[model samples]
Target chain A: MRALVVEDYHPLRAAIAQALRGEGFAVDESGDGEEGAWFARGTPFDIIILDLGLPKLDGLEVLRQMRARGDQAHVLIVTARDRVEDRCAGLDAGADDYLVKPFAVPELLSRVRALLRRAYARKDPVLRIADLAIDTATHRVQRGSQDIELSQREYTLLEFLALRAGELVTREDIRSHLYDFRSESGSNVIDVYIGYLRKKIERDDLPRLLTTRRGHGYILGPA
Target chain B: MRSLRWRIALAGGALAALMVLAGGAGLAFYLQHTGEQRLRVLAASQLQALAHGLEFEHGGIELHSLPESGLGWALYKHDGSLLAGSAWPGMAPPGSKLAAPAVTRITTPEGQAGMLASGWFQPDEDDRTGGGEISASLVFSTADIDREQTGLLLSCLAVSVLTASLAALLLAAVLRHMLRPHTDLAEKIAALEPQCRGQRISTATLPAELVPVAERINGLCDRLEQSYQLAATFHAAAAHELRNPLAGLRATIEVAAGPGGDPASALATCHQIVRRMEARVANLLLAARLDAGQVEVRRDEVDVNDLLVQAWEAQATRAADRGLEALWDLQGSGIASADPEAVRMLLANLIDNAISHADRPGAVRLQATTTDSWVTVEITNPSSLDGERAARLVERGRRGASTSSDARHAGLGMGVCCGLAELLKGRFSVSADGRELRAVLTLPEAAEFTYW
Candidate 1:
């Protein structure tokens, strides 16, 4: 649910960061290859969008180092250099996907959604538990033939938990995925958002899919 | 209508023909004159011999005719009466007086040409058989000699024509062989591309004399290839430069115009993108002009200290806005013979680079020095750039590792600085350590000073 964008162009980098943040994946971005690589190596980001021509170090070198350290974050290459050889070199160095610049933000969001599904080992775009169905692509949710609507933050919280259903997720993990570097650590924001999501998805007639594990964190689905 | 080769051959043949005719004509004339002289001498001696036999016997000259050696002879008295002789028809009218000896060509009655010698001969006036002077003439037919001379002339003409024809053929072949290199060279030149990138014509197989032409062509090819490469690099660099701003402009518009965006922030972003594009375009245009030698520098007396202070003011404002410290050390005031606007431009680029690359909150420093004949300016900034990275900063479109600012559209300041320094007839260089990057500009001191 967390993403990293490693682009150097200010306007494009900012735009991509905003788009990813808008898509409900907590986004962190850097304008240099060295910093990007450092962040990728240390963080448990689910995906990374990398630009090859980066300052301080090349993007390929960053990918190489990250992979050498066995950091398995799925990386997507986004660059203006669309030449065949440049694409090949970026991919060969361990990029999971490649996108040229001036890309449609919608397409980029869809690709991220697909990658996130793959990470969760879900072949279907819709994550389902019993009678509840959540369309990951469209951000629509339904429970036992009843439609459910939720706020952006509430939806992001529900999806994160649903993707990792049957397991416990820590507060720190939720905080990291739901916020950016510039956001203040308010500590109570995640629980408040969780309460909002619970109200919308839990119906009286539907089997309980959202749960809390005492003394630890939260879990979703059958357990 | 003749080709060049044929014309040459014809000229050669004509010269040969003229030489042969002149030589043959002279020889024929001399031979004919000698033959006539011999005929005349025979006639004169015969008359003398007949006179020697005369002793006034029978009151007139009588002599052994010597059986007429293909010559006819006659003697006439002063009264125009023939004394003793035989006459031939058409032999110079008999009454014609022969006062002195002469030889001439005459036509015999048979219409064939003959040589006649006429004279009054008086025998040596002593010794046996004293003879008296008498007017006489001798006529000898020249039919055989004339025929022979004509034959010689005809042979000369034949030989001349034949030799000229042969020489003409030889000359044409030799000319074609000699000029073969020209054709070969033309074909090679024709095959060459105007922007000929790599291929070069082989000069080794050319004739030695035409080797220089081929070499010159190869040299021209080298220039064309270099020009082509320059154009290509310029084009790619221009595109690389334009692509970033274009992406920025498009993405910013898209983000701001979307339903979830705010118009106020979008307006601000649009303004920033426009400003960035304007600055980039100006820098690229200047770089292009400088490279093409289209920029002209107007030299005037410029106060180095003032220029330094002005540049520092602009850069300091930018640094302060970013929460960084800027320091200036001005010393050794002097003058430089350079364009004021150009110097301002150079300083702006250098100071801008320093401020942008300086560590997020680190200090930037500017220093100036003036020696007896040189003026130097330097800027140092705390940075992550090392010697290797610093060395490449001046390359077109090469950005360094500082993210305090957008480096994706970086290296323009470095390019502008380096190019301006060259135009000012100065040297620009960079040095960096682990913690600091330094740029230096050293210029020649101006002699004239105008106080303001």
Candidate 2:
């Protein structure tokens, strides 16, 4: 994936560049906001990483110019200001995402991967890991050669866990993801749904991919 | 004369009043004495005429050209013969030979009268005692004395009233002129506004008494203008520096931790970043607010025990993580009027300092006490310094420096604490016990203090 990095600080900018490169992204860089805006307006990229404070022109103006010129590449705003108004203004100005500074490298790579994957709009989107395929486009689950008939909610629960494979997914995360909300169910509904997904998608002999991290939260990863 | 500017007017007027009264009284007295002398001379001349013109024939004496308006004369001979002439009512005629010259009061058939008499008797300047013949004269002239006294009284009253009025007018004009500079200064001060901070109070061409006051006012305005600009610059720079990083971090977390990503490590890292971001934002906001003079603290009487417990809730987790024991000994209850937000900020800073710097397992103590006049809260902790060195830690806080090894924790130095203390209408100081550092906060007792 290709991304544009707009920042003035040389060390921080280089760090972001190296992190993006490790994540397999072709990155174009600009130190000044005016040049960055021009480059973004003329080219097509997978995502645009724009800093708020830039020399010669402000970062908001750059975003406005890019949006005005009809460029819809995913624009993520980067700023040191963790204020509510700044975030709201950036998003309202056509920024697809807003991030505060000094972020971990893995987190940045993950967000870039998510944005790229979303832009693709997978037809017949399915989440698969270790021989289990939960087809979102078809609302069906298949374990090896077995065609599992499952309810819509059980399929959603299995799909949410299979999306992030090999990491602990909290019950809160699973409940929220399956229902598109924080759970109103008696807090053990996630355990019941996981039981259903276990019965439908995994063999009684297979190792589990969904796990729990006590007291902290949850994870969806390899056993 | 009652006006302060009319010093001379009042003094001169009083002196003038004294002089006028004394002069009027002296003139009245002199007129009375001179009038008596003139009346005596007239009486003597009348007696001489009476002695020369009298016709002592048989048993009567006849006198002419008498000027007879309440004037009467009588003659008495040494031979016990009485002679009277002229008819004027309310008059007295003397009997017997006069022993000496006199002015005496006499009683007549009508009323009391003044008679000026000359004891001169003559008989053709030859036989003055013929047939015991004697001549005596008495005159009545008391009405003139009454008129002269009335005129003197009227003149004195007129002079006194005129002097007082003149004194009042003179006093008013001089007082207004002397106070002119102060009035002008007041008008200039009223015209000044915050936008006119660059404008200076000019003392040139003003009274010498007003120059120092004007200079001080100008110096104050200059400092205010500089400080206002400094605050503006700080806010602008802090905002500009923090905007991009925070935006980037928020976007990264929302996408990375939401769905379809490694959740365990990502959430942990995101939480840490959020905590730091929250601290930095809070500190930056506070500094900007202090510089701008924007926050109006709502001062109210807060129970120190209640406030200490509330502050501890926010810092308890951090304290536990650092292995420091946090405790409060709130004794006798006392009230202190303070801004709750500022007090919270101050106590958090103090407790945080203790948690970061004190040795592992070291104890932090917050104690509250009140005398009759003042309520004090003392927060003490274990430290490496003693006595004077501990005292210097407080001075360093007031002066915007760190005196501890854990100074970098939370971005709040002692200077911020000092600033917060001032905002709360209180004082922040430090003391020590041997090797332990103790910070003290003393405020006026809320029950006794009055707010403007």
Candidate 3:
């Protein structure tokens, strides 16, 4: 999955970005609200971590402008304003979650994971398709009780495809979700990762769960 | 008297009592005068009847019959001889003659108080034995009139007392009713909560006399609310400044505890974050102390040049990291009569601010000079702060536009520097020319150092 962090404080921003990247998320960072807004308008991020206090523009105005432009990314506000009124205002401004500063990294990661689940309209942490099971929380996959191991990039792509099981996911969708703005991968990187995922998850003993339509996209359900 | 309502009521009651006493006194005097006049008229009529009843025969006067009126009467010859009267001997002095009709109050020899009327009359031809005038005197006792006057006075006193008492009570009740708005205002003011901002006394229903009082109180409330809002903003800004580094420190430690995390780098970052927090807290504490007048200052001789150099050396690493150079122009005598610790603290904050905000690859200029027992130090740097932001540089918790990116500077340094300068009996000022910012600090020089 891909995410964006918008915070003015350097050390805090670096820490948050580092923690998210370590969790296998392709993360993009901005130092101010103006640049953050610009990035939000230009990219299709799955989640946006925002701070309230910013220069050149306030974070709430940026969120308002983003929502006005119909961006559907889930926003999690992290700020030092701990007042009840401040929290209510942040939540009322279309933020998906709120977290005060000095928060534990584990809790932030858990909240991000939950927001991602909500984004995909799934209540369970594990996605099931026929006999195949993918534990999203553990980033592990199995087919008919046979454990499968995949690389980080391969896992991310498979997770994206599995989230939309039985539905066609285009290559552009995979590229936006699997890579950030800093990623220099060519157009075929998505196809390369998909091939790697299929080699590990597909077997001769099981029915083919990965299928591709001609000149269209890929699906991760029964063919 | 402390209660305004009671004061007004008491004054009103006293005035009413005074007026009632004066009116009652006048009424009693008038009743006594009329009563005396009535008695005089009755005595005069009885004396005339006695004069007419006299029948003079053989040059002698005789009363045919004494009228049954409750009066004493006597008839005397014109020569002051004995007359036919019942109480003449005790009514007047013996041999007292009447020349004309007259009335007078008298106390008879018998100690009877009476009004006496006396007159001389000429006898008619048919009833005269000789051509001579007859004198008659009548005396009416004033016992009943005196009794009636006393009773009237008693009744007047009773009525005056009753009226005065009633008037006092009525006046009190009326004043209380009229002053009800003042009471309501007191209750309303007492009910105001200090925490409730924008709560004001309504003057719309108040009396015209009390409108100004209510308006003044409302104005005070407005000022208090503004002060409360400013304090809240300052607290929030301080929290933001402190909590951001804490969060960073916590995240760094967490990351360091994870697998493949480097401990040395995380520890360095945590130390840096803690030092930054410590600096901010120190600045805040100094500011609070300065505001409360709790900071102690000494007049020890301080070496301005040494303190400045030390301050620069302390922040040299930071300046070098930011790729900035320091230009020194220390031309002063290098001495001032100020507290050494305060001067060091002030120089440290100024240099820190200069290093943090100065443009990279630019030089920060530090200059010092002395003029007649005063040492002045100026720090100038290439800054991006506009005129507006620089003007407010000394205000507590006010940060420059670009400071949001840096968590190490909490905008308290400048304010604390200004406060410390003042505590050391110095002046501090800042000015911006849109391209650069300059801070000037002037302090008193040592008395003996002036000759050096």
Q: Evaluated with DockQ, which candidate comes out highest?
A: 3
How would you encode candidate 3's per-residue C-alpha lDDT over B1-452 as one tens digit per residue? 29999888888999999999888888998998898888777777877777777776765656676645346776655666655656555544234445546888877766878878887777788655344766667777787788889999889988998999999999988898999999999998998888548699999999999999999989988888866765664576577767888899988888778755778988988887787677777776776677557899988888898899898987787688767888999986878999898898889888888876664368999999988889999999887667666767777656422324322252578878888888888999888776787889999988885443
Ranking 1 against 2 by lDDT, winner: 1
Give the per-residue lDDT digits (tens) of candidate 2, residues B38-144. 76776666667656676645444455556453356656555534455443443333444465455554444465445556454656644433554464656665665
Cα lDDT for residue B67, candidate 1 = 31
Runs of candidate 1 with Cα error greater than 4 angstroms are: A42-47, A63-150, A153-223, B1-89, B93-151, B169-192, B196-226, B299-323, B332-338, B359-361, B369-375, B395-412, B443-452
Task: Give all candidate RMSDs, comma-separated.
Answer: 6.6, 18.7, 6.1
lDDT of 2 at A92: 95
Separately for all candidates shown, the number of backbone clashes (residues 3 or more apart, or on different chains) is: 0, 43, 2
Considering only chain B, report the TM-score of model 2. 0.44
iRMSD of prediction 3:
3.6
Model 2 stretches astray by more than 4 angstroms: A1-223, B1-70, B73-124, B127-137, B142-145, B148-152, B190-200, B223-452
TM-score winner between 1 and 2, please give it: 1
**Residue A196 lDDT in model 3?**
79
Task: Please give the distance, in angstroms, between residue A12's alpha carbon in candidate 2 and its true position after superposition.
Answer: 12
Candidates arranged by lDDT, highest first? 3, 1, 2
- The model with the greatest TM-score is 3
- Model 1 gets an lDDT of 0.74
Worst 10 residues of 1 chain B by lDDT: B399-408
What TM-score do all the candidates reach, one by one? 0.72, 0.40, 0.76
